[model samples]
Target: MNQEQLEGKWNQVKGQFKQKYGNLTDDDVTYSEGRFDEMLGKVQEKVGKGKEELKEEISNW
Candidate 1:
C-alpha cells in the first residue's frame, strides 16, 4: 500500500480502536502513529530498505 492507503487504513483502525476502547483520545492515537513512524525509520536504517518496500512487506504480512 502507498501513503494514501496507509492513512486510510490507519483511520479505519483508529476508529475501531476508539470504538473498542472508549477511553482512547485523538492524542493517544496520534502518539501511537508517531511511535510507529519512528520505529519504521529505525527499521529502514538498519535494514537498508526503502520505506515503501518495508511498508509493502508489512502490508503483505
Candidate 2:
C-alpha cells in the first residue's frame, strides 16, 4: 500500500501497533490523528526493525 492508503487504514493497523508497543496508550496512538510515519518511527525504535521491514509488515496489516 502507498502512504495515502496507509494513512487511511491507520485505525485498523493501530491495534497491531498497540500489540507491539504495550507502553503506548490508545490515546497516544489515536491522538496524533493518523500521523502514521511518526508512529511507525516510534514503533521501529521500540522494536529495533528497519523501515522496509516495518513497511512490509504494515502492508500485510
Candidate 3:
C-alpha cells in the first residue's frame, strides 16, 4: 500500500487498541509508531528494499 493507505490502516489499528485497552494514551501510540518506523528503516537498510515494498511484505505477515 501507499503512504496514505498505510497511515489509514495504522489509525484503524490504533483505534482498536485504544478501544480494547482503555488506558493507552496518545504518547503510547506515538511511541509505537516511532518504533515501527525505526524497525522498517532497519529492515530497508538490511534488505535494500523501498519503504512501500517493506510495508507490503510486513502486511503479508
Candidate number of the best lDDT: 1
RMSD of 1: 0.7
Clashing pairs in 1: none
Span of 10 residues, lowest total lDDT, candidate 1: 52-61
For model 3, the stretches where C-alpha displacement exceeds 4 angstroms are none
Q: How would you encode candidate 3's per-residue C-alpha lDDT over 2-53 as one tens digit per residue?
A: 7788889999999999999999999999999999999989999999999889
Give the TM-scores of the predictions, in the order they appear. Answer: 0.93, 0.43, 0.89
Query: Would you list the rank order by lDDT, best first?
Result: 1, 3, 2
Single out the weakest 10-residue window by summed lDDT for candidate 3.
1-10
Cα lDDT computed for each candidate against the true fold:
0.93, 0.78, 0.92
Candidate 1 residue-wise lDDT, 1-61, digit = tens: 8889988988999999999999999999999999988999999999999888998898888
When 1 and 2 are scored with TM-score, the better candidate is 1
In Å, residue 52's CA in model 2 sits off its true spot by: 1.1
